[model samples]
Target: MTIIQFPTAPALNASEPHDLLLETLRAATNQLSQAGKALVQCDSEPAARVEAASHLVSAGQSIVAALNAYQRGLQHASDQAAG
Candidate 1:
C-alpha cells in the first residue's frame, strides 16, 4: 500500500470557519491522491478497476469545485470585513 503524506496544519476551533474549510480541503486532496495511487496499483478485474478510476476522477473534480467555492467565500468574507 502506498502512503501519501499530507501536510498537517495547526488545529483551529470551529469558530475559525475559514481555517476549518482550508483544513478540510487539504485532507480531501490527500485522500484523492491516495485513491489515485490505489487505482494505479489495483489488480482487480478490468471492469471494476475502470469503474473505480472513473469514480475517483469524478470525486477529484468535485473536490476542486468545492475548494474553489470555499476560497471565493473566504475572499468575500474578507472583503466584507474590510469594507
Candidate 2:
C-alpha cells in the first residue's frame, strides 16, 4: 500500500470558498488514487475486477467534478480580487 502525502491544508476560514474547494479537490484526488490501486490489486477474479473498475470510474468522475468546481472557485476569487 503506497501512502500519498499531501501538503498541509490551508486553514479553513468561513469566508474563503477557495479553501473549501481546495480541500475537496485533494480528497477527491486521493479517493481516485485509492480506487486505481484497488483495481490493480483485483488479480484474476473477473467479477472483483469489474467491481473495482466500477469504483474507479466513479472516482474518476468525482475527481473531474472536484477539479471543475475548484477551477470555478479560483476564477471567482480572481474576479473578486480584480474588482
Q: Give Cα-based local distance difference scores for all models.
A: 0.61, 0.62
Cα displacement (angstroms), candidate 2, residue 74, comes to 1.0
Query: Candidate 2 lDDT, tens digit per residue, 1-83?
Result: 33333233244453455666666666656666765676676666676666666666665675677568768878987998999
In model 2, the Cα lDDT at residue 43 comes to 68
Scored by TM-score, the top model is 2
Name the runs in model 1 displaced over 4 angstroms. 1-44
Tell me the lDDT of candidate 2: 0.62
Model 1: per-residue lDDT, tens digit, 1-83?
A: 33333333335454454666666666556656756666676665565466556656755775676577677888888999999
Report the number of backbone clashes for model 1. Answer: 0
Stretches > 4 Å off in candidate 2: 1-18
TM-score of candidate 1 to 2 decimals: 0.51
